[model samples]
Target: MTASPTLFTRIIAREIPSDIVYEDENYIAIRDIAPKAPVHLLVIPKNVSARLDEITDAEEMGRLWLTAVKVARQHAADYRLLINSGEKGGQVVFHTHIHILAGWENGPDSDT
Candidate 1:
């Protein structure tokens, strides 16, 4: 049987609409539908690992972080890189993703 598509997969396919911020051979970044800060972007791998634990190599993880950092710097704002690993980790979407939040006017400072 064919696997079902995740929300991010559909977005990447352009089956659903999204504000794409960046795109490359292996990844795509989009504006988060729910804003947690003045600036928020969701960076996801096109490879579609359902969760961090499912990732087989460091390459994908490395690429995701590199992209996130590039995006954060481009925005010229201090940023938070968040990855909610599993259900207990508060990950709403099954597809693994990085939440890039910046331009924090008010909020507790990130521990990192």
Candidate 2:
């Protein structure tokens, strides 16, 4: 049986509305509905993975980080990249993604 579509996947299909920041063929970056920082964005891969650990391809992983970095640089001079691996690692959404937090005058605002 096919797994149900994830929230990110739904957003990718535009089924759910989101404040999209950046989007390309393989990734889409959107503003978090509940932002923890002054600037909080989630860079999600078009290809879905339940968790970061679930992805084993080196090139794919590198590309994901590259996409996140590209989006972060577009939004802020200074930013952070974060990934919550699994439920125990504080991941609420199963889709593998990188959080780009910025817009802080000082350094990182949260331990994350």
Model 1 global lDDT (CA atoms, 0 to 1)? 0.86
lDDT of each: 0.86, 0.92
How far residue 64's Cα lies from its native spot in candidate 1, in Å, is 1.4
Alpha carbon deviation, residue 77, candidate 1 (Å):
3.1
- Cα misplacement distance, residue 6 of candidate 1 (Å): 0.5
How far does residue 99 in candidate 2 sit from its true spot (Å)? Answer: 0.2
Ten contiguous residues minimizing lDDT sum, candidate 1: 103-112
TM-score of 2: 0.94
What digit string (tens of lDDT, one per residue) describes model 2 on residues 1-112?
Answer: 9889999999999999999999999999999999988889999999999999888999999999999999999998988899998899999989999999888776775454
Residue 80 of model 1: what lDDT? 83
Candidate 1 lDDT over residue span 68-110, tens digit each: 8987788745778899999999999999899998876664364
Question: RMSD of each candidate?
Answer: 2.9, 2.1
Which pairs of residues collide in candidate 2? none
